[model samples]
Target: MRHSFYCFALFSLLGAAALLGQDKTPPAKLVLKAKTGNVTYDHAAHAKREKNACPVCHPKLFTQDAKAPVAFKPPHKKHEDAKASCGSCHRAGGTAFETKGNCTNSKCHVKATERKG
Candidate 1:
């Protein structure tokens, strides 16, 4: 019984850890699928980026087909040139509020050879 109790405690701790680390970021499926490059943009993590503001940048690069208010539409979209879309600004990178790397030189962008990987 003690072993079972320990297991439950361990799981609870892990659960809490996951929640703490979880990117509060909502689903970015719309923008994710629309991207043209192999770049993986973590919207949640990005939101946490200090100087980055979603409203300030998103609409300029992306377009709404329905002509409805963004609040009335889902946060993401599907199937389009993501780079030519939202990626345009993000491609250049931005100032970090709580993280590292310049917005333009960010890992998501960086001229091919400039990438850290």
Candidate 2:
């Protein structure tokens, strides 16, 4: 009985410390699927930049509105398009979210180099 009591106290202290040490900001991005690209919208950064409340992206990308519990992992199973109802053009010819811009240049997520087959 005494051993269990001590264990409980230790667990409580650890839990409190973990909570205190956490950042007030939401930990991660509000990832959404779009036809152009699988968008990893940094919620913390976006909130800071836009100065908006949590509801702006909550219940969807943000965890504050989680209908189901989520962990530090990808939320959806399918690609961005089908999940969000974004048509194929979002990834292709000339809709909106094409990867043609930043991907091709050194700016955004440009690949290191092309390898020959």
Candidate 3:
């Protein structure tokens, strides 16, 4: 009976450790599609870059739903006037590059190459 109790405690501890490990795991990238292109967002990378400040954007700039509809419609505007879109960051003097004149940059856009038959 004592050996069984020890085994149960060991298993419980292991289970708890596994759960804790998941809490630190990085989140998968979220893809936001636009008429001109798609934006791949690595929440984990951004969180790490921001030192894991979830409250900085949670329920405020962005919601918990990674698939939530962005505040703007597409075609990728040239100006950064939409506060609830990717422009929130990809604007002039923003945390990221400006989307106005830098739309074709590889970091913000993945240009499609011509396909051969």
In model 1, the Cα lDDT at residue 80 comes to: 20
Off by over 4 Å in 1: 1-25, 28-37, 50-52, 63-106, 109-117
Consecutive 10-residue window with the lowest summed lDDT within model 1: 72-81
lDDT for predicted candidate 3 compared with the true structure: 0.70
User: On residues 43-105, what C-alpha lDDT tens digit does candidate 2 reach at each position?
Assistant: 465567547765544544435642333322222223333433222223444344544344434
Q: How well does candidate 2 match the true structure, expressed as C-alpha RMSD?
A: 9.2
Stronger candidate by lDDT (1 vs 3)? 3
Q: lDDT scores for all predictions?
A: 0.43, 0.47, 0.70
**Which candidate leads the pack in lDDT?**
3
Candidate 1: the clashing residue pairs are 30-77, 34-82, 50-97, 92-103, 92-104, 93-103, 93-104, 94-103
**Clash count of each predicted structure:** 8, 1, 0
Model 1 CA lDDT for position 101 = 41
Candidate 3 Cα misplacement greater than 4 A, ranges: 1-26, 72-83, 111-117
Looking at model 2, which ten-residue stretch has the lowest summed lDDT? 70-79
lDDT of 3 by residue, 1-117 (tens): 999999999999999999987654445787777656666778878888778888777777777776687665544454356555666677766888766765557565565678999
TM-score, predicted candidate 2 vs. hidden true structure = 0.32
**What is the number of residue pairs that collide in model 2?**
1
TM-score leader: 3
- Tens digits of per-residue lDDT for model 1, 1-117: 999999999999999999999665455423322122234456556556535576654566534332322221122122121433443333334232211243244544333346676
